[model samples]
Target: MSVTTTLRPPATNATAFVPSLGIALASAAAFGSSGPFAKSLLEAGWSPGAAVTARIGIAALVLLPVALVMLRGRWHLLRRNAGLLIAYGVVAVAAVQLAFFSAVQTLSVGVALLLEYLGVVLVVLWLWLRHGQRPRRWTVAGIALAVAGLVLVLDVLGGMRVDGVGVLWALGAAVGLAAYFVLSARDDTGLPPLVMATGGLVVGALALGVAGLVGVVPMTVTAADVDLAGLTLPWWVPVATLSLVAAAFAYASGVSATRPLGSKVAGFVGLTEVLFSLLFAWLLLGELPLPVQLLGGVLVVAGVVAVRYDELTAPREPDPAPSLTPEAPAPPR
Candidate 1:
């Protein structure tokens, strides 16, 4: 999405602002936990595809009732927005998670997250090239800084050997994430965010199931116990956590927060997921980030902040003129 397209117009009412920010942060925290939890399952011999399928599938089941209630006889909305729902499910939900999980099999959680987040930059480029929306100066600077930070985080100059397959998977995840932002920013459908999120999860889960059944992606799971924070627990423990908190709660809260925060600010706020993921990985998986990588993370946050600042300070578009229908003649008088 272009900077303009991504940045929502300022909220006229300030009353709901704090609550929205809280919800967004909560969503980030939940999403941030996914990496560590999923990685734990992977370590216990679950394939990425299987883990993600289970995550989305169970989460969809959990949210189905709430979604139905929210529809409240407005069920036609689902039918009307089927195409968008399918696109959101397959690309944004299924593809993104699958790619990221696959990448994490070979990459560190923090690194994988940072790579996936490059999708934000992809959004800017896609908007510029496809829509001819030139980015503002701040966006340009943010992109430049983020790119530099990515290089540092990857340690390309350090010649740290990385898996080519993992890199490809991470990039794929990035593209999927960019598609997510673009799709979420669209307002034509008028579908409620909660409904959209719930439907997307259900469709995405079904798609993953079909993919697994077709043998397109490996689907493997283990009954073995999983390790978490120095304790060994049944395999289902992490799976339940992943399904409920990371997938269901995270997606729901995220969609709700986006409505109030706007796509750009919400997206920038989502940068916290990287940090939260890193923290979780360290605490749960004993994978601490290096000093250089931490510095690079700082730069990434700064870049996003600058871009959002520009969006906030940008001039507002004037309201359109009222319709000019001619007045009816006073025939009765």
Candidate 2:
């Protein structure tokens, strides 16, 4: 069997650009809802570790068949990029969930998210350092404004004391997430996104399973007391959905989209996840941010815009070949 991979060429046409934006927005929406939904599970008495483990474990299972079908003709790529793929799943997907859950247990969902958005600025820095081009002055200014806005959003100065270990975990999530984008953009040796997606979740699930077995995290589940809108449910159901849909679909789509949207562009656009989460919370839980947090939210958007203004304004790169020539080869020397 043969396999084909789609590499993300920069989008130049109006049609392509619009679809990328829509995909990115949809991904953000799915990811944003994860927090509140996960919170419900935790409130139902699932420990953070167990909840996170279940979410990824189930997601891995859901994705396995898809990966198998996609990689059926080309299993060799898995061996080729095994290390990078596994790292992406473990660090980016698994670590982010565990950290965010811990953060939300102590901090409000909005506040925890506001801190995680720091990854945007971190991505800007990563691009600058890795590529030797300074982010535009506007981008710098936006990052500053956004960070300041996050302080306001998080109310870091208003006697907000973060849990030390939790804070560390959240920071780790940021680092892992940034690496995820950078690495996902690298070639996966022509593996399909489904294959890459499956491979990552498998590695993450295995690692989490081992941790559970070693007593680092408890794997046992028992029914807990909780009621939701007149529905009786096991505590694991919500967390499991979070893992399979929110985290799995979200991560796979987000990672796969990197091929169509460059890493830097994807990072900037992903800021929408915060807004989506806020909207979900408002609608689902009737939870509204305080007036101060609202202002902070605006700053976050402004900051992201400022940071990304250059790419938004810069001319798109030209396509190398005509679409009609599907088998276009490298120009002869």
Candidate 3:
């Protein structure tokens, strides 16, 4: 806990920037792999609820032993951070995945994802209004470019007419996405990234399971083999990838990256996941992206680099020196 607390202050150690960036990009790649794998299962008769629940649920089971090992004799830390873990599960995990699935029921996946990724913008706005961390000129430019690129990347311009209910669901998911970065960046909870990731997976799995049982989310699954690319593999292959790589590794690495990068830069870098998602989809599902989408991916990368550059180059504000004596009280009116 102390290590997380002491090491997480933004820009505290300039030497760590590049490695953290690498880890962040790796996390994005892992997250991006989810779509292609999930698509395979869905095509094989697995419902969205079943896919999402199994992704997080089996991931929770896999990580439980590791979390317990890390938390040896630190039960007090878990007790103290219970609310944070619950919020992480509900907002960052369950709401985000569930709402996205709901939106995709009526909107094209690209359109639904575009709407949900509006959370990147919400992160900037939330920081400006809530934390008074106004963006400088460079950050503003980065945000603008990132958004324009996202439009092209998703090719929402060529999208079909969307349902209002689906739009609402995507918007709700946007809020959850914002919570994901904000909560992931928090260091006050005194819990390690692994613990946070494991707890979130557990809580999210439980919440989604309840929804499935209550008829809120449809739960259908099959034992049919999944056809990924040209190969016929067991259904468990994609399921394993979703749970282990996407849910477990992605979240653990993402949480670790946010500590050094802070929420703003980390959120921008996270845009790379869209590009990776397109890449994986093309490779595994034969969904090739248009040239314009490729161009958009370039812009997204440029924007993220700009934001990271701004963060690294920004002047550090040193802690004020401790006063030798108390200042005199101000004169009363």
What would the TM-scores of all predictions be?
0.85, 0.82, 0.92
Q: Candidate 3: which pairs clash?
A: none
Per-residue lDDT tens digits for candidate 1, residues 1-333, read 122233344343457667877888899899989887887898899998999999999999999998889899787887877878888899889999889877877876546766888887777777678665567898888777776666565554565346889999999999888777676665556677778789889999999999999998799999999989889999999999999999999988887786666555566667667667767888888988778868867876787777767766667678998879988888985
Q: Which rank order by TM-score, best down to worst? A: 3, 1, 2
Order the numbered candidates by lDDT, best leading.
3, 1, 2
1 or 2, which is superior by lDDT?
A: 1
User: Where does candidate 1 stray beyond 4 Å?
Assistant: 1-18, 103-114, 129-133, 150-159, 162-168, 319-333
Winning candidate number (lDDT)? 3
Local distance difference test, candidate 3: 0.88
Query: How much is 74 displaced in model 2, in angstroms?
Result: 0.6
Error of 2 at 8 (Å): 6.1
lDDT of each: 0.79, 0.69, 0.88
Task: Give model 2's TM-score versus the native structure.
Answer: 0.82
Number of clashes in every candidate structure? 0, 3, 0
Clashing residue pairs in candidate 2 (N, C-alpha, C atoms within 3 angstroms): 8-259, 55-243, 139-307
Best by TM-score: 3
Tell me the lDDT of model 1 at 135.
79
Candidate 2 lDDT over 101-136, as tens digits, reads: 667667655456656767776766876776654678
